[model samples]
Each structure stands twice: as structure tokens, then as C-alpha cells.
Target: MTARETPESIVVVLGTRPEIIKFAPVIRECLARDVPFTLVHTGQHYSRELDRVFFEQLDLPAPDVHLDVGSDSHGRQTAAMLEGIEDVLVDVEPDVVLVQGDTNSTLAGALAAAKLNVDVGHVEAGLRSFDREMPEETNRVVVDHVAEYLFTPTEETRLYLEREGVAGQVVVTGNTVVDAVYQYADVAAEKSTVLDDLELSPGEFCLLTAHRAENVDHPDRFRSLLAGVAQFADLTGHEVVYPIHPRAQSRLDEFGVDVPDEIRVIDPLDFLDFLRLESTAALAFTDSGGVQEECCILGTPCVTLRYTTERPETVYVGANCLAGLDPADVVAAGSLMLGKQPDWTIPFGDGRAAERILDALTEVETDTDTAAATVTPTETTATETLQ
Candidate 1:
């Protein structure tokens, strides 16, 4: 390693748009403090929609390394990410390897770093859906167990951690999802031409995104969800902006679900543009967990198509709803939320999540004994109900 390669600390890993948005604030904190860091892109969602432009729009440094572990089945994708992340950890030896949320990349990276004693920090930790069938719930649970530092976005997540008997350093930093929105929304609002180009205006359209594995893994469910949204948009005479994921797009072609001429299926927007549109939209319909949170933060009510969510606070608070695969339910939920005034005090955190997480890491590294005392071995409950 050269002198430039030998940074004292590195905030190590992220993949997917959610990870990018959440961790960008952490990276900003590191840079502001002159703390050394290196970013590792695991390439779980290799499409430009999930990668590339998000980095550019967020003003994040180009990743020092990219694994390019593209799309595949859950098992194969994760195994590939494990090998790829392990290789990078061996090469980089970052003092801290931080991962965000519950993607396969997050679980694989956290496990790899923990096994190597690399002091892994799990951002957006302690989230649970109590559903084992959902791979993401499993990933989040496992990542939490392996993480040396658990940065929760809400008091609810913190309580979930304590209930699981995880006594590791728990800090209630606000959700970085909110942080990303605050940081990027203004810039995206000003710069994006998506609204004008699509002839969309706020309150006259509904934003749609559906790319979750459970929803996309089955052709019938995928068809129903898309058809439901398209049909509802037509019946209501509301413009629908559907930014289909590459995976979902492939499935659409495979299943012969032609993109409705009336439905605007376009390339994915960067974070800023997406946020800007989401902010001004009448409502959002999607299977994306981050989109659900972003919509809540932006005060645009959402109808989450999935049956369950790790972020249930949104549902409980009525900022979102679990409309499942049924088109009727989705239509009703969309209409209901569209007409209702959105309650914006989301149960998630204030925008100070990254700062609190960094402060905790600083304390943990400096006071080894106190950090060690905080660690007590204990059994953990499983999150297998969401699927």
C-alpha cells in the first residue's frame, strides 16, 4: 500500500440506491472532519438506475473499488458478494467497515468484516419485520448481530435491539434516509427536468416503483401490481410515472406485460430527481423500503405494495399502508392517502443520524474498555414473518 492507500479509517461498504442515500451523509461527516475513508461498491444492483449517477448526484467520491457483483438469485448473488467483499476487506484492512440496511450486500459485507475482526458498524441497524420468509429481514437481523456498532434511526429500532438481547453499543441517531432527502431534495428540485419532460406536475400524478424480490420474483404478482397501478391511473385520469428497475423490466418482457402506453415507463432518475418528483407528487406506490421512508419524510403519503415492511412505523403512523398484491387494495389505499393530509412527523429520526453514529464510533474506538463492557453475548430472536 502507498501512503495514499494508508488512511487511518475507512467507512467501507455500500450498494444499492438506499445504501448510497443513507451513507452519503456519513461520508459527508467523515470528510468534514478530515477523517480518512474509502468507499467500496459491491455492485448488487449494477444498473445505472441503482448505481452510477447516484454517486455523481450525491457528490460522493468515486468508489476506490467496485466489485460488480451483478444481479442473480438470492443465494448466488449473496455468495458472490461475500467473496467479493472478503477480497476487498483483505486488501483494504479498513479500521471500520460500515454497511447500511438489509440488502444481501450489507449482510455479506458485515459478516465478512466481523469474521475478520474489522470492527464492523451496521448503519440503519436494529430494523426488523419479524418475518423470516423475507430475505431482507433475515439480512438485517444477521447484520445487527455481527455489527460492533448499531446505528438505529429511531427509538423503536433501539427497543427492538434491546428486546433481541443485543447489548452492543446502541445509539439513536436519526435515520439517514431523512438526511439524504434533506441534502439532495433542493438540488434535485432545482436541476431535474424530469417533471417538465414528462409533462408532470405535483398533485396531478402518482409516482410508482416496484422492484422488491418478493414482488418481482413471481410473474403473476408482478403483473397484478403493474396492471393495478396502470389501470387505476387510467380510471382516475392520473398520470403515473413508473421508473421500472432493470430486473423488473426484464420480468415485464418475460411475462409479456406490455408497458401501458398511458403509463410513462422511463429510465430511472438519479436521487435528486427522484426526490424532487416524489416531493411534489400526489402520492407514491412502490415496493421499495427506502422510497416508503423518503415519501414519508417528504410528506407524500405512500402505498407500499409489499405485505410487510421493516419500517412498520410508517404504516402504524398512517404515512404509508401495506396494500399487498391486490389491485383493489392498492387503488383504495392510493386514493385514501392522496386525499388525506399526510402526517409528516415520521417516527424515524431527526437528520442527525450520521453525526450520532460517528460520535459513537469515535467513543468506541477511543475507550476500548467501555466499548468492550457494552458487549455481552446473548441469544437473538429471528425476523422471518415478513415474507
Candidate 2:
């Protein structure tokens, strides 16, 4: 195959902390290899506390394009992102678009790029919850089908794609989330003053976070979950440090649910503060997908609040237990797992995910005629049937 000039540009998109953390290594790798690339900020997360702080503290390259498509109804948020992202794709004309994980922004970026016939590469691909009720599950499935390169984080994920007959090379490149945690945890632990500020000793507090779209959308479930956590804290006499998500905060306000005094509702934290909190906590209760991997890697036990998890490797190994949305179950699971010895191990690979992703992207067999050739026969068949 003839080697064309190096790609004019590749676009890396981020709108959340997990995306930033997971994409950090990939971005740095692109720079180290002198690959031409640009960063795009989708503003799905608009707060300085939630979004900008991460980019600043991590010393991530400032995003070349910022689409401040802030908070809105789910459909409105996604639709706004689609229009904004498509415009960026047109202006930049990137050869490939890289999106991470199952977020609204991820799906928007992928759809925008794929619609334009630009090569789309999805990092952290093949994660499945098998529950269509989850918007994230649908987002993951759709993006996988459309992505040109699927950089899966585990062997399970790779198999998941193959079982669905997804075309493209599926590479189990380990998880970049592990890569971020491993690379930053040590420095963060030493540098972060989060424990001191919170006025708590390490291992004395339980870290809790609940910000999934599914959980927050339902008022009854969300209220019960919060009340149960508060009860657990009151009963155990252990402080609960919850770095609140913006969406969750709005929901609490709308529902007029008072955040119990025992459960501390703090502003969203940057990566370092978050890691310091995660590493030092007695245990974590969360609805987040990334924290499951981070807690397991840190040897911290976790009780997931959702009914199902895409990161089942952590659950299968026993690091995490799914407590669903029931308040009683949350309290019981939280109490049981807090002081227990963590037996679960991460089946996600050992921190080389970024390198593997880079390798896969660079090594993909680029058949220029593949899209056209597949379309011609389908079109011919349609015409013949009509005649």
C-alpha cells in the first residue's frame, strides 16, 4: 500500500473527566510520536469544577475547538452537540475522530464523524450492560457499529463485538483508565491536600458518587438512594464524602430533596483530588463506570449503585457488588464492604492501553474502496428487486 503524507489531523474529543483521564495518555502519545492532532471540547460538562479544572491541573493541551453545548434536555443536549460537532468536522476535516466511553458526547462525536464518512475510532469500546433502558448501552452499541477502529479495553469486550458481527479490527489494548490511575496515583497521593481539607483521616470515610443518567432521571430511586446513604452514614458514624455531579445537584434541587447533613455534598473535584479521595477512602459507593476500575486498582472495595455494570470484570473478581437503586441494599452493601478485605482483581490489563490503541490505529489496514464496494452491491440488489 502506498504511504500517503502523514494525516493532516486527527480529532480527540472530551466532555467529561473520565474521557479526559482515559484520553490523556492517547493525546500525549500522539504528541510524542509527532502525530498531527487536535483536541475538541464538547462542553457536555460545563463547570470549571467539573471540566476545566481537569484540563488545567493535568496540563492537558488546551482544546483547539470548544463547543460549549452546556446542559439541556437529553435529546436537546445530544442534538446540539451533533450540529456543533459536524461543523467542527467540516472545518478541520480530520482523517479520524477519537471518542472515549459511553457518554452523550461520545455518541454525538462518533455520529457526526461517521455521517461525514470520516474514519471514527472509539476508545474503550465493547462495554455492554445488556440493558436497553440505559442510554449509555444504546450509545455504546451504536458507536461500535459505526466506528472504523474499535480499541477495546478487555478480551471480554473484544468477544462482545465479534459476537455482534461488528466489522473492523477489535484489539484488547487494556484499559486506559488503569493507565491514567497508575501513572498519576502516586504523584496525586503525595501532592493532593484533599484529606487535610476535608478534615478526615485516611480510611475513616466512605467515598460515594451517583451521577448516572438512568439513576438521576428517576425521582423515587434517586431520593431513596440518597436517604439510604444518609442512614448508612448516620448508623455507622462514618462520614460520607460525595463530590456531587452538576446534573445530580439540579435533580436534588428540582425534587426538593434535602441532602442529609451527615452526607457531605462537596463540589466536583479534579482528577488528583478524586484519586486522593478514592485511594484513601474506606470504601466507595458509586454509579460511575470509571470508578469501579479505579477502586479495584487501588485495592479499595466498592458497591456499585446500578443494577448492572459494563465493567463486570471487577464484579466477577469480587471487588465490586451491584446494589441497584434500593436504599436498604445500599446501606447493607456499603456497611459490609467497607472494612472487608478486597478479593477482586482487575481483569482489565496492566496500564498499556494507550500504547495498544496507538498501535492499532497506526496498523489498521486502510482499504479506500471498502465503503464504496460494499454499497455498490447493495444498491444493485435494491434496483434489481424494484424492476
lDDT of 2 by residue, 320-373 (tens): 888887889988888778786654445666666777666556644444333212
Listed in order, each prediction's TM-score against the native is: 0.89, 0.90
Q: Residue 92, candidate 1: how far off, in angstroms? A: 2.5
Task: Indicate the residue-level lDDT of 266 in model 1.
Answer: 88
Q: Rate the local accuracy (lDDT) of all candidates.
A: 0.78, 0.81
What ranges in model 2 sit over 4 Å off?
A: 1-6, 48-50, 363-387
Give candidate 1 regions above 4 Å deviation: 1-7, 48-50, 364-387
Model 2, 221: alpha-carbon shift in Å?
0.8
Candidate 2 to truth, TM: 0.90
